[model samples]
Target: MAGPTILSSPSPPSEEAGTILLETERLIIRRYFLSDAPAMAETGNDTLVTANLRAGFPSPYRLSDAEAFLSTACKPDGTAYPQHNGIFVKPLTADNPSPEPRFIGAVGIIPKGDVYFRTWELGYWLGSASWGKGYATEAIGPFVRWCFDTWPGLNRIEGEAYGSNEASQKVMKKCGFIEEGTRRGAAEKLGVLKDVVNFGLLRSDLEGVKELVRDS
Candidate 1:
């Protein structure tokens, strides 16, 4: 529900889109499939979930939109999304052994361009039922590690939340992202303009956290 400093020299697109389907201790962050459409429709269509997000996330999100999203997300080896390697899908599921996990949320990055090749914009959303759980923070830490591991050139990943989304801001902070700053009235949603709060994690931040983890 709300978006990096990017300054890099022009570089060739990487060899291939990362084939990462990460399994964290509590989450299965992976690609989207046809089966995810219903749950995606359910969560994404909700204004409660989308209230803080961008307009690209349509209100009254239809089954068609989910279908389209899945279709686009599940692109082939040849078909790629518009920007860089495209917004790869990462629909999170509980890591329970029983009662097969369902798609409870989504996460991915929109790669930046121009002077921002080494940076990306991150985004994610969880169902209201999943709120108050540590899922966002839990999912992001590994995702950050995955990005650093998979795309060696990427230096930072950042996200923006509406100034009102304090929960999301806290989630980012808990995941080791720094509170960079805010842009006043930089976004408009539902006929009103709102300020945006920015949060970010850099490769150096990940390295620092890993060192702390090992030290402890």
Candidate 2:
């Protein structure tokens, strides 16, 4: 079997206000750089990649679209939402570390409004080339855990996927999200309506699981 990979990038200035946010065995999650636009364009251009995603990403995603995304999703210093990070492939060899991590996917959360301020809606996607590699499951675990730890008042993290998107549901399940409910005909893509399946992980649920592991 292949060995694990590590990702490294040039450290920005302390005053620059940007740095890697998290790391897993085969991935590094960080803020988006303007230089990453080309890769995002390529990945988002694939229909299979954006097929199940929400309305934001344009079909045949162009470089302009990628630039726009970086503009909105990342601050001028590239550290807009620390939790909504770009997924990059780590280096396969320690001696030959990549100067810039390979952009492959992303994981992010959007805060709910009004009465649901304590809840966050989760979303993620990967290039088709990176699919079936267990990267999604690996990336989400740390990301979700970090969200709960960073915000003391946060109560729940929720994820919704189209009913046919079993792969996404599986990733959420692996990250400890429970199937809370399904909204029938709640989503429409390409003029077709599909059921929307919802999953959630509570702060208490995560704490309980950790407690169980410690006791066992």
- Clashes per candidate, residues 3 or more apart or on different chains: 5, 1
Point to the candidate with the largest TM-score.
2
The pairs that clash in candidate 2 are: 6-91
Per-residue CA lDDT of candidate 2, range 1-216, in tens?
542221112432121223577777677887777777898999879999888898778998999999988776656433233544689888754522777577888887777766787788898999998899878888887888866776666789999899999999988877888899999999899899999999999998786455322221
Q: How does residue 80 of candidate 1 score in lDDT?
A: 26
Cα-lDDT of candidate 1: 0.68
Q: Please provide, for model 1 over 98-199, each residue's C-alpha lDDT reduced to its tens digit, 9 standing for 90 to 100.
A: 555656778878878767878888888887767776777777677667667766678889988999999999878767788999999998899899999998
Given candidate 1, what's the lDDT at residue 156?
87
Error of 1 at 111 (Å): 0.6
Using all chains and alpha carbons, the TM-scores for the candidates as numbered come to 0.79, 0.83
Find the candidate with the highest lDDT and give its number: 2
